[model samples]
Target chain A: MSAPDRFAPLPVTDTPQERGDAARNRALLLDAARRLIAERGAGAVSTDDIAAAAGVGKGTLFRRFGSRAGLMVVLLDENEKAHQQAFMFGPPPLGPGAPPLERLIAYGRARLAFVHDHHALLSDAGRDPQTRFTGPSALHHTHVRVLLQSAGTTGDLDAQTTALSALLDADYVEHRLAEGATLDELGDAWETVAVKLCGR
Target chain B: MSAPDRFAPLPVTDTPQERGDAARNRALLLDAARRLIAERGAGAVSTDDIAAAAGVGKGTLFRRFGSRAGLMVVLLDENEKAHQQAFMFGPPPLGPGAPPLERLIAYGRARLAFVHDHHALLSDAGRDPQTRFTGPSALHHTHVRVLLQSAGTTGDLDAQTTALSALLDADYVEHRLAEGATLDELGDAWETVAVKLCGR
Candidate 1:
């Protein structure tokens, strides 16, 4: 889930009334967390490492985010929002001004790439189906539904979108990968399903 | 998984070397395990309950299945084999007597229903993607691959098969159900995907 909404609630750092120093401190820690996650993966980075990397004490880390998981969720949400914005408003097929069918295909490719890149954090955050489906996934589904409508397709768009979203599930993607299915194979299969459904 | 093969090497009782009494004792415990799982759900049932219900000692239960999780895996394997047999040999549509498209639709419905009925046990047994994707899922994928071939569709049948299988994944199905998608909705979506993929 990309929204801080589903994750154990946003940390105290997210409250609008935070002091300037506290806000900067929160940003510093989050920046450090994101860089460390990118470098070594989400599962490998610890709160202790994050605090050390951010040049802060562990107490400040805990005080701001409550726990390591909370920090990870918040940071992941940032990534999710960025992905959503890129597709919704950035440019080209993934953004606006492209054919709906093209956007749909682009969306699938981008989402598959997203899951592959951020699987560790996504898997850890999406412990429940609700969280897993509601946050970034819900946004993705709505995007697909709109694209399908714009593509001049008919029939239960709700169900269609849900079924389509199922293809990009992080756990499913990871499962396939763990079983030796390459990213290229997943992308090919996704293209097959997407093109068939879009009637292109 | 549909195979008893991947789940801890096919419990001791499955070997032909078992004496009549040992076979009977194994049957008793297994029957008890199934009953308890069906009645109260797998999560609520324990080894003690199965042992007591089967009129055996807890040690016998462990000796036969190794552990509680092991027992659940074996019990689930039994269900998977039954499902596999029903689809592979039993009757029209679901069995070998109908068109591949019809069989494919029937397979989706049967698998969805199977996951619904056994979610508790299957979820408990399949703690890893390796086990979940390798066993019964492998057989199901092969079944779908053959159906896709028979329907005369071309284009990476292996990858196409994998994508279609993702639509029926137990975790995906359960996730949709948890997110308020009804079984009917899931079935409809499956029909849409199957018919579209099969071009029937």
Candidate 2:
């Protein structure tokens, strides 16, 4: 069966009528939030700190992102979108113009790096099982499923996709890193699994 | 490095000096909780309902297990111990006598079934990332790591173990089931991945 058209760019849900300064304020808040989170960790960075750093009123922060969790979701979404764009469109291996097996290996490495880097934000954004498998995750599932199908992976495609995707989960990746495995070691292992699964 | 002696049976923390009637009451309450949870779902079954169904007072239930969350931990521990025993000491492929690759494959299948069966209880017991990588999860990691080492699998055994264990996670299993994949299909996919990783 053909894969569904699930890779269309995520919907741009921002209101179209927002004035220029409103958009600027939104960027300022997200930038400040990301910087604070990087310095102090997600839990330690409060909404008030984020607003003060952005030089905006706390009310502006709320008006832009609704709540602290909302800001987290948006921050995570931005990073996820950039990562998605690289894999979906940017260059060889991780994007296109490479053999399926090679692309698959590259995809795993790239995804491991992305999860490792954004572990804090991604973990804070969603732990709900219902939401875990939807949105960007659903798209990720489709991407891996299509790649496996192309590479002639013979068993259940959906299950294979789920298996691969699970390896890149933010929590799992963070746990491994904490246990003293380097990111390079993880990327190499992921490549090994990808090659084996692709029957290379 | 030798695998740590992490597979020793989990410590039995129950107070050994309890009276026979207290032991019976604890058993009664746990049985009732399990039955009610199986019938109406874990979320639907309340502490009051469990006490009422077990013919025990609400105070007795609290005195026995401390709180609803504590009861859930004990309930999940009971199931986990049984699973651990089966794999560690019970019989063959899932136990000891079989080849390492075959045992790994069997382990994955058995673990998938265990997660699928107990998804609700496990999902409710702990979603905290800190708690996730400890306790039973840590033991599982060691088990799979030892199996991979025995199988002579090359490159980053820890990462490979994490990859395999992540696939059998409760939330991942539940999400796949919700998406309509069968347990058998998951097992087959897991076996395929295990065989490939083991170089069979």
Candidate 3:
């Protein structure tokens, strides 16, 4: 199934009516933040460092993202959108062209990789229980549900989706990694689950 | 298989050498707290109410459990022990003597019930990521791993156990419940996962 409008990228919260210069500044700051975060880790990258890296003043950085925490959230959202694009529309396996079960396995591995790479930024985002089930999470749930249905798995799809998604949760993934499981091992384990659920 | 020493109840941290009367007071306070929490939700119950119900002064309640948060932790620990005893030592299905896969299914149902009944308290206790993988969580992992190994399941046991446990997490269960899934539906879905993993 093709990616539907409901699966659109997470809405960027910046004002829609911003001028061209403001939009450019926003993109520059986000790019700089992402680069700095990748280079020095999210915790080590300061707002000042991001502003200096973007060649913008500190005031512009704060105005763009509100606070350090806000910037981290936006960064996560941006990354989440890229990930959504990959599995929903990019190519075979993780995208639409592969078999349902294959796509499901690829999705788990890709999602795990995303979480592994963005662990610091994600952990720092603070999982607010109230907001955990909305937005990007809801989209992920829908995507998985569709795949599960497509795979011809019988039983309660909603419950299965929740169970599967729980395993892919960022915090749960981090907990497993901390407990000494490699990302590849986690991905393999998830594939086992996906295969089992598809009753192959 | 019998419950091992390692799966014993969570260690109660109260001073072991307390006077007989102090022990009595401690039990009284805990009983009162449990009764009050059952009658009124955990958030609605208070240390003062617990003290009054136990026919003790607030000072004794404080000295017994340290503080409100301390009392909640001890309460959760006590409940966790009872749950551990049931699955580890109690009879059949959830305990011993049942087929490994049946036991696994029963374990998931029992665990979902535990989290369902203690939803407010568990959520109130807060999920600290650092301590999440230790203590009771670790014990749960070992129990599930042992069950999988005994059932002759193939693939990564640790990873599989972690994935399974993630679905049974209190927060994830609560999230599903809030999203309109019934406890029975959750149990059924879990049974499906267990059956598939056991290759039944």
- CAPRI docking class of candidate 2: medium
Cα DockQ of the candidate 2 complex:
0.53
Indicate the worst ten consecutive residues by lDDT in candidate 1 chain B.
Answer: B126-135
1 versus 2: better DockQ goes to:
2
The model with the greater TM-score, 1 or 2, is 2
Question: DockQ rank, highest first?
Answer: 2, 3, 1
- Listed for each candidate, the true contacts retained, as a fraction, are 0.36, 0.77, 0.55
For candidate 2, the chain B TM-score comes to: 0.73
Evaluated with lDDT, which candidate comes out highest? Answer: 2
TM-score per candidate: 0.70, 0.74, 0.71
Error of 3 at B171 (Å): 2.9
Q: Indicate whether candidate 1 or candidate 3 has the larger DockQ.
A: 3
With a 3 Å backbone cut-off (N, CA, C), the pairs that clash in candidate 3 are: none
How accurate locally, in lDDT, is each candidate? 0.77, 0.81, 0.80
In terms of TM-score, the best-performing candidate is 2
Q: Weakest 10 consecutive residues, lDDT, candidate 1 chain A?
A: A127-136
lDDT of 2 at B186: 83
- Residue B149, model 1, lDDT: 91
Please list the residue runs of candidate 1 whose C-alpha ends up more than 4 Å from where it truly belongs after superposition.
A1-13, A16-40, A43-72, A171-185, B1-40, B43-72, B125-127, B171-185
